[model samples]
Target: MNKTFKIYAVIFIVVMVILALLEVNKKEVTDWRKNFDTNEKSPFGLFIFDHEAKDLFKNKLKKIDQTPYNYYNTHKKESHNILVVETEVDTESWNKILDQVSNGSDAMLIVSQIPKEVSDSIGYYDSEISFADENVLKLTDKKYKNDFIKLDKFPSGRGFSYIKPQVEILGKTVEKNNSDQANFIKIKFGKGNIYVHCEPLFMTNYYLLKSGNIKYAQDVFSYLDDKETIWFVESNAKVSRFFMRFILSNPALKYAWWVLLGGLVLFVFFNAKRKQRIVPVIEPLKNTSVDFVKSIGNLYLQEGDFHDMMAKKAQYFLNKVRLDFLIDTQNLDDEFAKKLQLKTGKTIEMINEAINLIKKAQDPYAHVMKEDLARMNKLLDEILK
Candidate 1:
């Protein structure tokens, strides 16, 4: 599969596993109840509302209307319970709601995409922060100060306001504030609590079907187990804006750009500095004799000058016979012709006739008989033979 498909496949498998665990745990709880419909009509299938969670915690809670920030909002004033789950939430909305709940005795929990501003806000509200494994949670001991301070920090260091809760961090590599985790954090505001989870896959409808953290989900919304709870689910454009930030934060993209730059630099360096090798050049030989003869023949033929071509051929044959037999043209007798014939293995009459034909010139364009040209050609061939 292509890389993108593989990534999507991996995400799909992880979601399926979480949903499977949720489903399996769901079947085990015969007393499980559902109150709100999360899948009322969502295209992304990111948020899943638990009506059972609201029913189990009935009377003590109220599901709030989903603002332009939170994905799922459920509240329990009696139990001081407020649970917020979403892919992301706005800082202003979060702060306003936290301020409202902190004034009272309610607890708030938020799950969303993390921003530096949100992290700083969580730190502002909580006294103790601890990070362990890959999870971070902020705790405050305003109401139960004694119980909150005793929590141990991982690796025996001064813990931040947030503490790692349940998951073990040993042997697990934590990517430095990577966007892959979906930027999740939890904090306590006065008597209330707040949580921010980066990736919503852990709480999506597909994940709730088979999530292994049924107890965690229960604990998260546990205040609703005893009283009436409100389940509010929604999608906001503001929360989705954080997704763009998350995508741009990918380290792979940064590294890919760096690699391309490096490759371009190397290509320029090698091509610019390297010299091309020089080699000896050879001149090709030319054949002029055949070319010259063919040129003359073509020119004569184009002008319909057959007499000139036939006379040239006859003259060439006469020069060749004189050189081969030492023939004298001064004798002008059949004896010289006979000697030329005997030496060259040709008849005397053929030689004499070829000579006569070469010496005589006639009009080439005249309506000459075809038989005359044929006879001349036959005599020339015999003389050459």
Candidate 2:
């Protein structure tokens, strides 16, 4: 490497060393974000519940990553209760899920809130809102009125005011002194029922690990009559995430990775430059007018066609006289020769000789010699000059 490249390398090493030191010395804190990933080990993840749910459904719990619409669409002949705990479902998928419920599949939506399109389709407006703390979850049935789960700090809160006749009240959220709000309900869709519970945080690993907290979730799910239930998670395999984390934790490996990436970028940048080809030198075309006249003159001399050559000379001389001196040589008699001598300021002898050559060339029966052609050219040149 050169001086500039070595300086950049030193700067990069220093930055990487600083980043590694900061990563090693940083304080560890608990991650309370609600992920609910099947493979995640976070407090809010469903890793614990996913393994334990097999016993509740009698070894018939099938975990899948597809949406409710996709699962039910593929397995049209068969039916099973579906559990959806994911956040932010699209309107089309929500409608398709309800269609599957109508066909014959009890779907439990344990989410933070119910979608407005679903509520509007069912002829009511119902959704959940996040509450600060001290929320109580209980069923609406008279006998289970006293049986309730109380949380000192929870986020699930909200219920609908207007209830349609087709809706069956299942559960309620009772705050400290506030009136009861229907947080959970069941709607009879053609051959099946759709259960909507707003308290999804209770089904996480944090709550399930607590003493007797899993029973509350079990009691809420006891309403489903299907022997087997299909749990929908995201479309991802339960694989190890330690390969990248292991590389990033070591300073040497991380530095090598960054250096390799930079080398590849530099290689591409240098190779992608525009290249130009060499332009060749071209000579101009030769003047062919003089060569063409010389070739025709040689051919005429070899053929011994002295009359044709003399005729060409006569035509050229007459045209020159007409253009330069404005003299007419149509008849080429004594009158024309006089006019030519006057216009060209030549002697009468040269003018008379040019006129005799022109008249002899014009006659078809006249025989011409090479000497006659040469004399005619000499006389015309002297006169025209």
Candidate 3:
């Protein structure tokens, strides 16, 4: 069993070492789509190096690390316009944002898709843009109306299909004069306006790096130039803040953690048995009294010592008579015989007979026969009764 356990241990160690080596050498590619974080590698991520929008806000861009609703309620009196980029809005946050925007502060939402509740609340719909060839985007702004820029690639996803009649169009696709497929719209609320843009990836790494593309994004932000502070929501990228999140995020580390937990449980279950104290083996005691008595009896029988046996029997009988009748057994005279007769309810002849046999057995020089011993035993038995 020990040898087998050692072999399994060696195999397990070898497998772990190989896995570690493979993981060390593995090159992992960062998935860049729909990850609109502040990191550089994400296609939609805002970085100071690439996207000019970061420079446009600069120190004025205050990122809300927590949920929008929390920030809004905490700083409700403060007038800060929200800048939501490539983020899915929850109902509660959406409602809060709507309330904040309707009261005084404005908001700009740049994403590939918007939630159904938000879209329904403000008469807006989305369209699926086909990825057959390069998508040509046209800015309907009077200043850049003639500048229709054609792109090799754009963010592949849904776009704003329709908007309310009261919504003012800012940008549209150059394919057709369909206002229904407009990419940008501005909806006026109670005291502020909501700027909605369909393609957030246009302002990301791929398109933002293109020639003249930065100016186009700049022009789009021109609508919100009046706002002093822009609250950039950073909820999606919040997981990067936790140390354990990194381990749980990786497939190898997560699996290893589960395996380690399982091994610990198994060790506790098996090693607990090994830690218990050993139970001692107990031997039963021997009843040697009967055996010793039987052996001594057999030794006398083999030697043919009828004299010794008769003497022992006569002495034991006398001892028993002395103890039971409370009489002196030293003398077996006629008076003793009468006392023995009255005590035992036996005849005088019987007592006399037993006394004569006992006297003969008591004689040291006398050679007693087996028949004499047997007659003495019978006479003693009757006298005792």
Candidate 2 lDDT, 83-121, residue by residue in tens:
788655677778877777778878888876677867776
Q: Provide TM-scores for the models.
A: 0.31, 0.59, 0.59
lDDT of each: 0.46, 0.76, 0.72
RMSD of 3: 41.1
Instruction: Report model 2's TM-score to 2 decimal places.
Output: 0.59
Query: Candidate 3: deviation at residue 91, Å?
Result: 1.1
TM-score, candidate 3, is 0.59
Maximum-lDDT candidate? 2
Backbone clashes in model 2, listed as residue pairs: none
Model 1 RMSD in angstroms: 40.2
What tens digits encode model 3's per-residue C-alpha lDDT throughout 1-385?
3554565567767987987777678776665555666665555456632334457765466666677777767775555567888765678988888887778777888877766766776775666664324566667878986555555654353456656688888887554322335777888876877888877766666666667776777777778855565555554344553335777999999999999968965775566445458989889798999999999988987999899888988998999899989989889898789788868988889889889888888999889988888898888887776
lDDT score, residue 255, model 1?
Answer: 78
**Minimal lDDT window, size 10, model 2:** 267-276
How close to the true structure is residue 212 of candidate 2, measured as C-alpha lDDT? 73
How accurate locally is residue 176 in candidate 3, as Cα lDDT from 0 to 100?
35
